[model samples]
Target: MDLERLYREDHTFFKVIVGDFNAKIGPRRTAEERHFGTHGVEWNEQGERLSKFIMTTHTIHGNSQFQKPSHLRWTWESPGGQFHLPDRRRCCSEVLHGIGPSSPPR
Candidate 1:
């Protein structure tokens, strides 16, 4: 489950395995879910850590250019033990791509 470490060890093989990755793969490209992974996006420490691992692995070890934030969150419907619920953005997976110090390199 330690995706970061996995990437760190094997990123050099990405080209051989999957070819040059474009780094545009992800969710949340809609108007409503646009801020899904933005700075203000809500997440616990574990979530943040996973996000950092994924992004860093892609950028540094994999030599890839990231577009959006590679983070995620569970919606209200996915909470309280109920699998489905009305009036909820169930799969709001859009993330914000930034260019600040926090952003991944180009």
Candidate 2:
């Protein structure tokens, strides 16, 4: 995708990408502490892909950077009211470091 292309072309630019990636990266894993936090849902197939991309591109998962209440974590609720999904945000480490501790907006 465009992100991959951008990363391939240049590795120095400050970048921040936010959107509904439809990928569930879940909570932080053993080796993923640098990229994820402790307040995410379960991981899925797409989550693996996105996680790989984040690692490969040296990007931080913005949504997973802070601790949020379970209620505020998900961006979409199922029509049946039985499920919730997240839309993620990612940014270069440079940008991530500039941000201070805070919670996600309601």
Report the number of the highest-TM-score candidate: 2
> How many residue pairs clash in all the candidates, one count each?
1, 0
Q: Which stretches of candidate 1 lie over 4 Å from their true place?
A: 12-40, 54-76, 82-106
Q: What tens digits encode model 1's per-residue C-alpha lDDT throughout 1-106?
A: 4544556677465433233222332333344433233333344555445445545544432222333354542233345665534666776778767878977888
lDDT tens digits, residues 21-81, model 2? 7898888888756888777788989889898888898789888777877677665657887
On the 0 to 100 scale, the lDDT of residue 93 in model 1 is 75
Candidate 2 lDDT score at position 99: 48
Quote each prediction's TM-score. Answer: 0.28, 0.62
Model 1 accuracy (lDDT, Cα)? 0.43
Clashing pairs in 2: none
Candidate 2 off by > 4 Å: 10-12, 77-106
